[model samples]
Target: MLAKHSKNKKISDKAFITSGKAKLAISKYGKENVINATLGVLYNDLEEIYTFDIVDQEYRKLSSQDLYGYASSITGDENFKTSVKKIVLGENIESNFPNIYTDVISTPGGTGAIYNTFKNYIEYGDKVLLPNFMWSSYKLISGEAGGGYDCYSLFDSKNNFNLLSFEKKVLELSEIQKNLVIVINDPCQNPTGYTLTEDEWEKIMDILKRACKKTNIVLLNDIAYRDFDNKALEFKNIFKDIPENLLIIIAFSISKSFCSYGLRVGAQLALSSSHRVIEQFREASAYTCRGIWSNVSRAGMQMLSNIILNKNKYLELKIELDKSIKLLKRRSDIFINESKDIGLKILPYKSGFFITIPFKKGIDSKVSLELEKKNIFALVMEEGIRIAICSIPSHKFKGLASKIKEVLIEIE
Candidate 1:
């Protein structure tokens, strides 16, 4: 017999099995011949994993105390918290959100930030709202926190953020639950790369204003892929002067940004109108930290803090990140343009690590089998096929979109 909550647990995610299939295909064929695009991690044209030189150098320079000693606080080092805000809000922090009081609590990764928010805010048996196309982890995190999740249609007929459907779902959910947690993965959403325009953000806040009248709003903004965004810190201004009843949590991750995915450095950024609400967030989050992972990586926190606090290292890191962002954009351009040439329609992909192409639901298995037979591997989801542009080489991207279209045609 299993624990009551553990009885219904999933054995493994489809992505993992799909990836295993890709690896097996590579073994059967050859690495150079296979297009393994199942992972979200960045890779170079040579099919090697990418990491920042600065992060590697700094980590090696840290003392044993910095590496092995416990952090200054269970929440995190105070200076590390300050550095995270500076990096997130940008050098001109005053202009980002003059009215909102902010607080930070370090976590394992963006996953920890989102899970902590759900564990504290989500009531048992209630539900959080997510985009219909999202990282599968949101559902897992919600379940672990004793809650369920629903979704709003992510795109309209024209392939823009579906505000009407979003508002409808929010109102419908509010009617049933007193507290509502809506997860918005934007700038670069998972699987589907869609970014909301400034006007769209305004409309969402406006909807929340009305919805907040009926229920307490806990809006979790997952910005794990935000470093690739071309909009930069300009998007931070959207949260300024939000309603007091609405709490905003920014899921910040150093994993992708610093290539420290194994180190697991991340933080939960809380924004609200009332200072008291932020303080409550700090207390409740720290308690969760104590109960869960205890404390995050000291060396990882120290390294990130140092890079941000020092002018030279900060510039160096920024330069490196900017290069990766540009590289990702270029790869996306190749796929988007080639897909258009082949008449293969893609979802609205503003910027991100992955791009999605919609197809009939029942054709995924056949399409995936065909792709693997041709030594091409990609994530097959319910809505579409996900191409990890970050992991795929630019040269390889040139013809991938067409091949996928060909597969779809064959299967259909």
Candidate 2:
């Protein structure tokens, strides 16, 4: 009785479901007894959702019209577009690659930016290239676009970026498909917290430059957690001198950066050496935005533009964000050092919100369920159990690794 595409579609977000269970546990037992490391949102030591004060002040300054009015353009407000490029690309794109053509389109969240790219670029039955350990939504998004996906091994024997596997897969897919789409979640990548080094990016560019000769390439960089990494802008030097056939999309999110998770504001900034391609992107992306979701939150866009453009407000926002970064570092140190001491294995995590503990392929669900019985909630993935270091308080991180290790031992 349902339409073909709508029928037999199973949709359940494990992170939200697990987080719900964690909340129920907290209600049953005191907060001190439960560890809810399911969601990626920042939580203070007092177990409250943390918000940036500067963001709050600026948001309160917005006029009624700014809050309720439609965006100035389908591509987003002009100021929002300019501010996004400034914060994300900084001076790298403008100073280094003055000739590159760039355009920005506003979307609901980072997920919207990603989905828009997939819908416009991916042809039917084409597969996207992704990392072996990645946000599960990438696969779902691709499927919804009438396409599928394949993954390159994310790590190697030394627990580093698997450049060899990446090269092989990139070449293989480019040869098979007329247009290639690849997603790289970098500079505090989700789940695994792995950031690609500049050298690794240089190597990736070499591969892309070579592949672009055979097929048009789309590189989607989901930088939802970039604000948490101090070296984020430094690593973007690789964005320079990209081949004309390769288009780069930087997905920017206000959820983590502005601490405006509920506002759902984000943008897709498309960069290309070809003016014609970027022009096409601007038109296509705006059309998709109008069809799917007419316009993003105007209040969110106004708030971001105001803060980013004002020097004092921008400085205050940075100061507050630095504190959260320090807290994240402390939590990461405790868990990582303790994990090493107890001989618990975790994926290579440079900097980010989540840390993953890999296990036998089919045993992750059982492991997560067993941990839930102990009131420790983490997300179960195909490769591991994802522990949200961003949500866990630094004090709670002290003996947490050992407890999880014990459960892992018992389950295995």
Please give the distance, in angstroms, between residue 243's alpha carbon in candidate 1 and its true position after superposition. Answer: 1.4
Model 2 score (lDDT): 0.90
Tens digits of lDDT, candidate 1, 1-412: 9999899897577777877988887788878778888888888888888988998899999999999999999999998999988877766665667777889999999999999999999999999999888898899999999999999999899888899999999999989898999999877889898888888998999999899999999988888888888674364657766888899988999878887778998999888888999999999999999999999999999999888999999899888989999999899998898988889999988887899999877777787788887778788887788888888888887678878888888888
The digit string of per-residue lDDT tens for model 2 on 337-377 reads 99999999999998979999988887877887889988999
Regions of model 2 farther than 4 Å from truth: none
True-vs-predicted CA distance for residue 140, candidate 1, Å: 0.7
- Give the Å shift of residue 184 in candidate 1: 0.8
- Name the runs in model 1 displaced over 4 angstroms: 92-96, 233-236
Given candidate 1, what's the lDDT at residue 77?
97
Instruction: In model 1, state the lDDT of residue 68.
Output: 96
